[model samples]
Target: MKVDRVLLIAGGRSGEHEVSLSSAAGVLEALPYDADVAVIAKDGSWLLGPDALDAIDAGEAASGGHPFPPPVAWGDYDVAFPLLHGRWGEDGTIQGFFEMLGLPYVGAGVTASAVCMDKDLSKRVLQQAGLPVVPWEVVRKGEPAFVGLEPPFFVKPANAGSSVGIARVERYAELQKALEEAFRYDEKVVVEQAVSEARELEVALLGNVRAEASVVGEIRYDAEFYDYETKYTAGAAELVIPAALDPGTQETVQEMAVRAYRLLGVRGMARVDFFMSGEGELYLNELNTIPGFTPFSMYPRLWQASGLTYPELLSRLVELALE
Candidate 1:
């Protein structure tokens, strides 16, 4: 199947909008040399010509502030690849819209997107399904207190990504400030028990059934956590391809990644994140259904190390969607 036009949709109603733009640019660069690439910016506008930098500076999109333009017509393009992360973009919203528009897209469908977007919900589903997730509590707005979860915890928005509104608090006194910061991006905040000496590991799972897992990659954040800066800012962290792990542990992590993928009904591709404790326990962190497709992104990097190049990976994703 040959794709004529590839639409890389980015800049969404989320705090990770800037990162989304960066991801879109990477996708454009990875497009097949023969395919035509079109860039869509924030504010539901289009970007053309060679001035990518100038167009990005002209407009910005904020959550609940950027109104989507008229829905895209079916067959406007061969496939819609949304690199947007967080809230409106990663959740079922945009996926549902495209489905209604009858457009084929790269990545998970509506139900899977919605489940994976909600941290609390996704954890519940995974844990209930016999998967391992960290201890946490979901605090809805207006609650006088968040309890049953230990302090020195992480307070984050339930739906945002790239750790946009995540805060690490060590005491009860700091809970208020953390929740307030988290609420700025989302009304619901997740207070999770901190995992000390925890290793940040991620596995890129591609394909439908018989999905393959990229060699696990470990990320060392220069910052406290892998926040927006650590993820986007140059040299904010170190990426370890083929994370050092015993063969047994590696196999378990890969199996868990596939299990999580199917449990959530993920389709084309997903990056399953995990925390490798000192005891060698691979705990599920969260799954990124529409994980970044950038060249430097772990999703592609892991695959590259696993013998697939960026262009080949993009080609596979397009084929998976249109096949």
Candidate 2:
């Protein structure tokens, strides 16, 4: 069956714009349609059709030399496959736009995106849901933030992703700098106790009600933490799929991953990250509503290794979104 419309929106004002574009590039190639890609540049611009990439390089929202295109009508496409990550795209802003336009875009809805984008709220919901999220405190703007929270905790923007403005403060002396950095991204900041000697594990959750968990994967970053550089730049870190763990522990991780997905009301797909301590205890990490889509990305790779081909995975997401 041919899909009438599938706009793969990528690039955004957020720090993860490049990652989003990389993801959109992959989705553009895999979508059923041969020529239906929309490049949403970082500067609040839109580039449609074949020359989207060139338009991106031209540093404008639209391709020059063409008449200004009016705002796209909602009915233009059956589905909008948004590849936007962080800031204006993922924080319910674009999702709200899609809702106003009566568009059925892929990924979590507005409420889910809003809650997930705000780390403090996400943790609170998880805590209320009887999930094991690290203890955290919210430091809103214009307040003394250095006090109250324990030292050696993670300082991150309240509503940011891709580890943007994230700081791993190992001491009291580092708390202020970390808070400043995190506050730069957003008015609010989240400070949580660092889980030392914990292994980073990630599980891909797919679907809505009948969510399925992919084989657990682990991230091994050589840096002090899995910051932005360690996530995108080559040689920054290594990813281990089907992370080696005892059968019982593996089942526990899988269960936690699914539970987190359900509690967040996440739909379509999410990458649930966890911090497995040296004693085998697992702590819930944040969820990625719009994860990377590169061919080598873990989201697709996890499914591929679990018997789902790349095209099949891509098709599954679109199908799930439409449903």
Candidate 3:
């Protein structure tokens, strides 16, 4: 299917609002078709076109500052390419809204988006499917903090991206503050044992029914880990495409990434991250259904290394949505 008018949705009511806008900017610059822009304000107002604020409100009357019905009509475009990240956008809300509108959009569906957004649920599902995941424990707010694992553990919100609410606690004394910080973003928190001397590897997957994994990529950072700052700040971290892994290990990582993508029923695209322990054990980390598309983002860079240009990637994603 040839795509003409593309709905480029971006900026949502989430901690990742700025990130979403940046990603959408990249998409807007590279998209090959005629694309319209929609900005979802932090207060949940759906503003269409460049004059978002002062422009005419096309959505249903704001009911308590929440736009129940989106202003975008199904006939306005052929497909939607949502660059909204984090809570209200990537966590299945917008996906469901598009479904109700009977509009095809890029990335995973409602169920996959919701499931992958929750760390605890995604880990459990991956574990049940005989996939290797880091050993971890879950805790809820107001519950007795259980440092069941070792002191070097990571505390993160159950449903968040871009490392918004993540803490690396190296000692038991730091557990309380870390958990409290994590609880700020979500009621449920996850505590996972930190993988020591592990190299972070990521694989990008694309497709609807049949997925294809890109060449493996490695993340090298000077920080304790790939936190939010290291991720967005240019030069803070280096992405080594076609990660220097042995042939066997490279194939293994790519295969596992595709398996996880299919297991989660991810359509369109996903960036599957993994931890390669010093001991050679591979631990499957969380999957980002709608990974960042910034110039420095790994998802598009990996594809670029694998022969897909930025514009080509954007066009391919829109095509996947149409399919």
TM-score of 2: 0.92
Name the lDDT value of residue 316 in candidate 2. 86
lDDT per residue as tens, model 3, 3-67: 77988877777788778878877777788999887777777777665544222133221212327
Question: If the candidates were sorted by their lDDT against the true structure, best first, what order would they fall in?
Answer: 3, 1, 2
* Tens digit of per-residue lDDT, candidate 1, span 57-144: 4334332212345333446588888877888788988899789878888888999999998999999999999999999988888877
Q: What C-alpha lDDT does candidate 2 achieve relative to the native structure?
A: 0.80
Clashing pairs in 1: none
Ranking 2 against 3 by TM-score, winner: 3
> What does the lDDT read for residue 115 in candidate 3?
95
Question: Which residue pairs in model 3 clash with each other?
Answer: none
| Candidate 2 C-alpha RMSD relative to the actual structure | 2.5
Which should have the higher TM-score, number 1 or number 3?
3
**Top candidate (TM-score):** 3
Give lDDT for model 3: 0.86
